[model samples]
Target: MSANTPMLITFVIYIAAMVLIGLFAYLRTRNFSDYILGGRSLGSFVTALSAGASDMSGWLLMGLPGAIYLSGLSESWIAIGLIAGAWLNWLFVAGRLRVQTEHNGNALTLPDYFTTRFEDNSRILRVFSALVILVFFTIYCASGIVAGARLFESTFGMSYETALWAGAAATIAYTFVGGFLAVSWTDTVQATLMIFALILTPIVVMLATGGVDTTFLAIEANDPTNFDMLKGASFVGVISLLAWGLGYFGQPHILARFMAADSVKSIPAARRISMTWMILCLGGAVAVGFFGIAYFSANPDVAGAVSENPERVFIELAKLLFNPWIAGVLLSAILAAVMSTLSCQLLVCSSALTEDFYKAFLRKGASQRELVWVGRGMVLLISVIAIIVARDPESKVLGLVSYAWAGFGAAFGPVVIFSLVWKGMTRNGALAGMLVGAVTVVLWKQYVGLGLYEIIPGFIFASLAILIFSKIGSGPTAGMLERFDAAEKEYQDAHL
Candidate 1:
């Protein structure tokens, strides 16, 4: 009956679908393992889509495009970095992690894997790594909430608080109920929606702007520097952009998908599928931002052109280019991207709290049912904290995501790499690496004042710490070395 009715209806249906999937997944969950990792039953398709959806977040649709729109070719470097990082992560880390995690005491979380992988009976590895996941993931989840708030605020003309809750509600509801299976299944659907919206919106925008030639000319005419790949880009700045890929190794959520795949053998197919999807989706998102520059240059009065938030470019394009009904579906894709990643982050946080902290220390004898409910409760607690952190209406999604990404990349990247590949790496080496990496990121961000991204320095320092500590301290035990060798051998045999 009204102008906003169609959009409201579309959102209701989308949210409902997410909830129903959660309910279905809830029914299938039988134990703590099932709740945390879907009992490692994920097939190739679900594993691929879920991993891509979780890794990309709304950053792919909004932040990347916004960067492209605001700057130019310089912004594309982040995407290039991520693509390379993700591929390498799949190639080296995915299968090895899958096999080794299962082999090394069936580790259900990264922290758990570390303690077992290093044969650390002190449990310091688990505790410290869990703390890292909790701290960084909260910031990561808050970034998603901020993205959602912006979307709802623009779509409904609502207050930021209302939009914040509205943006987070579906994600919280689904993850709170369904756990890992629900998150993975819904991610598949959301990933498909995301791909369609990315493909469709770019096509419509290109058509509206009259084609590639016209758009390029408009971009050059509006600002000639936008075309130069190295424009205003320094060595440090370029390196910083490329270093974003390093974060992939340490990302708990993405690695969780690899750990959940039905078998190590399935990873090759999942890797192929995910990489293809990532390149296409990433390219489309960049096109939206590049074209937005041209489209808005020609028509300055368009809603998003002068908006305070440049991230609104994708949504504004959907609204201007499509009818109300189609626009509603298109806009929901933004919500899809937001919810898919948010749910995964929340679920991972839940696992860290329940599996690492509660079961490991607070209640070692806790029943499976009790741990599952405790995890569900943690989802609620963490979501509330994220909402509070995201309350700042002026916050930029890309800025928040960047800080969290660097934090994880620096903190866990070196440790994860060394632990998997270096048999001589000792437990103390792992501890030293994690501490140096995380501390370096924080201190570098605060005192260094350098133009460099924190991750570069953090990663280097962490890697060096691991190597130096391993050499000075007692190396890994014979058993640990043997397991490492077996895992690598199995990986090679599977591929061959």
Candidate 2:
């Protein structure tokens, strides 16, 4: 039998289980609301894990570990920034967004919330926000695709072209049929598998290296800078790394988790559960990369695959150090990571086309069944577009993710903050912030010589534009103020 048979069976079984979940969710889905947002019915456990799973993506397993493997501990500044940013987002934005979106005409998506929040009569803000989501999210989805492609190429020994479509097929099938509930439910299972793999792999590596002390000694022997967090890091570069948290505010997929919670009351518990899971998972990822440094240094003969692609450190290690049956389970965690994020991103893109464009313009009176079908069709459309974007075989998972992450963080972060908190914020202010944030990231990424991450500059410029524009633009209308005030009170009460 081929050595790849066990892993192949694992992949087939996992994919089959997830598709079964989609079929199960499809039976429960009744309308457009159920299709896109799960009818706002997720509990705290589901919400927490689904949010964390969708947020982490294959970036957590492949991209993050790869960076640490290549660069050492200095790269972990990004992890620190992400943890702080995610905590703040949960504390401040999650519950408030839940209450506010519900109050604002039960808005199913961010564009819908923004339209009602500022009373944008011209629907200009709605159209613009939806467009921004499509653009950045398409890029974001491409990152997931690239990560998936890498996994398949490395594991199944498939050609890059074949892996691209093959890797995407299962995620597309589940998401196309079942929508948010399937994504969320499957996320919960995937999150469990991811944590199990992350925790187990690092511990096994540590034991193989003798212990923590011996592991560090091996790492130090390979490169002393691996232990030095500040090595070659400037103040600006560090700030840029830390700014990853800023993107959480504007992430439509994570925000949808907030929106789909059964009630605002669930946010506190969910935040606690989610944060604990995130910290552990991130720590484990860093350990896998850092510890692999020691493991590979000792066993250089078996390190060929990992040396060729640092991102394969986890994959190579899992296959090398564990029994084939066990390695298959661990490897499935990586697939889970890819599918969880890609599935949600596809659904969000589908929501944008179906809710923000098709229903908003072409068919205001479209029936619920028709809208659900439209959402499924949009999922297929976006998947094809993202596949096209991901056609480049040389794409780096972290590089692509950072670019798309910056675009969303800059474009929508400040606008979300101001709209939710500042009573004085105007529709024009939101417009200004979104446009400036997005454009700055694109321009800075393409032309700027600065070594800093684009998110810091993009976020700063976007905040300034919102402040300046809001000052010059009109204040919130009475109804807007009333809704905002009422949502705030309800949010506070839920927390208290």
Candidate 3:
């Protein structure tokens, strides 16, 4: 047996345990509700941690770290923006979404909520929302697959294609079996593991470099600009880039957690827990990246010293600081971040396809069993497509995630936020807002090439589309407004 066989065995066992948990979750799941939301019984910790873990994903491990390594402390503004945006989402959006979704009799997906809330029993809203989810989520899920593949290729010396398939298969197996409950439970565990790993790595790296002062001096001496937050990037560029936080208002997976929370009362606690977790973990990830650059720069001749691919910062540090046994566990945390998100996104996309599109229109009579199978089939198909897209090793994880994130945020974020707050938000206005927001993001990413500054354009276009369309377009029907009023009243009374 190979000397490293124990490490491989441990990794395999960890993955097997995840799949088994999903299988067990499936066995215990009695109905679609159980599969999707665990009967909406998640506590504050589970909901907050799952939501944060799923939200951060590969971006936390690879993208954030790489950003710090490349751009220095200026990247911290992104963390600041995200934390602020997430706080607002929890404060304003979470309680309302959770209560209103249940009050409206929507149980399954975001499109389901849209149809129920707006009284658009017609198929147009459902189909449109489903299409948007599918389009953006495919690219979003592909970015995650790319992160997973890169982790495996860099750390385990696996082929990129092989790594892609392995990662996809693991994520798909669990999500397909366990559904939302499994995803949430696994995410809770994964999120905790991620926090531990994130914290431990940077402290170890700092000790390896003497201390913070020594590390900073080394980095500053190596490249003075690395110490400057906004030295290279312009003021406008910084604001525009950090505004990526605004996109969170519209993200389906994150908002889905808001909708699925057990109650409005859970939101405040969830918000506090989630915000604290995001700040610490994201800060730790950035430190890992910056410290990685310092560590490697100081010791260029260490065995397996990685230089060019700054993304390897985390993996290389894991290997250098720990034995293969502990490194394997640490490596799984990276995979955990990637898989937790991929699983959630895949299920979300599949639900949109199966529930929103297939059942809503194509086959109204589709049985739950048949729909379940369809969702599983869609998961497989999407995984295959993501694997195909993840072949390009040079594809930047941050850039891809940023584009997808901005697309969802700009297209859906404003509409979701305003729809909840404004009684007069019309269906046509919402539609227009979503279309313009999505189209604007795509055009900006493809044609504008504004680098980190693209998110601002998308956000402005989306917000304007919502405001203008609601003002000029046909307002909601009297019946729709009446229903909205009733739902709002019921929500208030229930909370009160």
Best by lDDT: 2
Candidate 3 at residue 331, lDDT?
82
lDDT (0 to 1) per candidate: 0.89, 0.92, 0.80
- Candidate 1 vs candidate 2: the TM-score winner is 2
lDDT of 3 by residue, 1-496 (tens): 6535655776788789889889988876766666666668788999999899889887788778888987788777788888888888888788777866776666478788777766775657778878888877887888888878777676667888888887778788999888888888889989988999899999999999889999988888778888787867777777876687887888899887877688777888899999999989988998998887788778878724455766777877887888788888888899999999998899888888787878877898977678777887888888777766677756564356657888888878888888788888876777777788888887877888655556577777777877787788567877667766776786677567
lDDT of 2 by residue, 101-169 (tens): 999999999999999998988999889999989877887888788889889988999998899998899
List the pairs of residues colliding in candidate 2.
none
Superposed Cα deviation of residue 356, candidate 2 (Å) = 0.4
Output the better candidate (1/3) by lDDT: 1
Better of 1 and 2 by lDDT: 2
For model 2 the local lDDT of residue 308 reads 90
Shift in Å, residue 61, candidate 2: 1.1
Higher-scoring candidate on lDDT, 2 or 3: 2
lDDT of 1 by residue, 1-496 (tens): 7767888899889999999999999999999999999999999999999999998777787888888989987789988999999999999899989989988989999999999999999999999999988888888889889888888887888899899999999899989999999999999999998899899988888888899889889999989999888988998888888988998988899999999999989999999999999999999999999888888888987744435778888888887888878888988888999899899999999999999999999999999999999999999999999898899856554355566788888788888887778788999889999999999988988799489988889999999999988888677788998888988888889989
Give the range where candidate 2 is weakest over 10 consecutive residues by summed lDDT.
Answer: 393-402
Instruction: Estimate the lDDT of model 3.
Output: 0.80
